[model samples]
Target: MSNAPITEIDIAAFTADPYPDLARMRAAAPITYVPQLGATLLTRRDDIHVQEKRTDVFSSEQPDGLMTLLMGENMMRKDGVAHLAERRILFPAVSPRTVQEHWKPVFETAANRVLDRLAPRGGCDLVTDYAMPVSAEALKAITGLVRMTPAEMDGASQAMIDGCANYAGNADVTRRCHAATALIDHHIDLMLSDPPPRSALAVQMQGGLAMTSIRANIKLVISGGQNEPRDAIAGTIWALLSHPEQLELIRQGMASYADAFAEYARWVSPIGMSPRRVARRDTVGGVTFEPGDRVFLMFGSAGRDEAHFQAADRFDIRRDTQAAISFGAGPHFCAGAAASRCLIAEIALPLAFRRLKNLRLAGDAPFSGWAFRGPTSVPVAWSL
Candidate 1:
């Protein structure tokens, strides 16, 4: 430990583009101490796999204040058998087939509308024009935020995204947190207003749930309903553009696009890195660590590790990415993974292929954050 270089993990460089430093760290020391965040960075598959499992030792405190707001009492931050019960309720919200069936019409409507508008022009920005809308609409539908003006939804979603993903320190984070909460609160009000006969929120509210449970569940569904779509949409658009030949193959019915989309999620690996604490003492990879020492489980790097994947550098969507960490792992795995996947299929796939053909990459797409990976602005010219 004394001989180890005190590497500084710059969240800024991570937010800008992290591949270079991630590769460097993975190559040199898969598990190394980083001074910047005052934490040990684990970027290797083995290292990350172990750290993520040690829920008692590492903890899921959500050090970023803005992130905590989006994930207040969210699943990953809690551990042990108790969280399992909360997940039972969350199960209905993210059931893959249920989500697919739930959002199919909504997604089709949104995608068709966007495609109709953009296809005539022959080309459009996938993020702003296509990806953003379908995801937003689907999320709005999920939160029961019906008939909200596009501008209001956009403003609310962008504020939440900024609050969760962008950090300017504690004070700024707190302010943005309130903004995000206000947005979600507005969404909750909409749900309570409509009540939708026997909808999810209706049942919960009718049950007269405790203020704590109500707030927690509301935040969970709405925040996920909001953010997951943006990442899925933006990330899928970037992937489709990057892999046009694959996209073309899929269009020709020569490929199973569902698996491709799943693999793409793994290859792109969004949500940055998440840490878990060890509830019991544990030893991993021959390294003994005491309880309460935070070990960073770098999912972004783990997806690219040689041990888990062959030719990990390639962005091939055809790869068999088995239960990839892009969604996270163990008991704390993402509850919204199914909805996210469904959203990609219904909205992202349709919008990308239907409206934009001949989708060629422009230049180096702008993006940031190793943990939360997606193109900031992926410029591409397209035609029908």
Candidate 2:
């Protein structure tokens, strides 16, 4: 281990709002090991952008890692050939063309259906009432688990996410995670028995991937797929409503919903930190890391890196966020990116704004979580 200074963080405070702490860390060092997280954090945009691609040294394949242990060894945890092979197989399901041709209509219907139900309410918690169901319905159709209700889909996804990030080894989290995976397995079994024509599960099944791999990958998709889009949908709406000036840019056609979505993701990354395992003795940013060291590529921090972004903390939809690593910079970049873009930018945001007239915050929208961050509840009102 290199002689890098060890950093201590208040776990609770960090979870509540990590930007302040992360800003301090970036200013202090290039790499700092945090005892609470049990991982060395790479908070700088430049370092993460460069080091993330160097998979030879910082590997994703961690057999004993929390993700592998809790959610099964999915492609996100693999490196080089293994990772690429799975990604290739999974590509057809989430490719840009596929997302446009197939999932776009599905997402559109889901968004409209959810909005149809909520539009009459005049006000509702956008998180549970709107974003959650829209995301879950779309994910259910895409994953070929249509048998699952929106609530079930959201619950399972949240449970698995909690389990994967259960760094504290909470028994309840692990139990819930296992229970959720078991439920997903049942759904997979049903789907495989009578596989849907073009769902992700059906596509992967046709690709001749193993049963275990297919199940793990499906669970992986649900874990990130449902929550990320859900978070982004609600979070982006909250951001826009909070920043009327930015929203005016969209209304005036100065900025598109896509621009708002990208900026919000950079401003409050839904998927914050990606964990990696040191594959061997390697030096990054003048700090040496030994084999088996856990590293957290802080996408949240990198997005707001002062060196890369001017007035980084402020949410500016007009700002170009090309340097943001919110979806990651390496080979393990999110496979669901196209789907997310279509869902949030194309369908969800545009539809929500159009359907919900005079949409504005009903109450304080509180956000939490550092690893996977978003508004827990976005209370909003709209003219019926």
**Top TM-score prediction, candidate number:** 2
Best by lDDT: 2
Candidate 1 lDDT at 268 equals: 65
Give lDDT tens digits, candidate 2, residues 170-204: 99999999999999999988888877767889888
Off by over 4 Å in 1: 1-5, 61-71, 147-170, 197-200, 206-209, 277-282, 286-291, 360-364
State the C-alpha lDDT per candidate. Answer: 0.64, 0.91
Cα displacement (angstroms), candidate 2, residue 292, comes to 0.7
TM-score of model 1 relative to the true fold? 0.85
Please, what is the TM-score per model?
Answer: 0.85, 0.98
Name every residue pair that clashes in candidate 2: none
Clashes of each: 16, 0
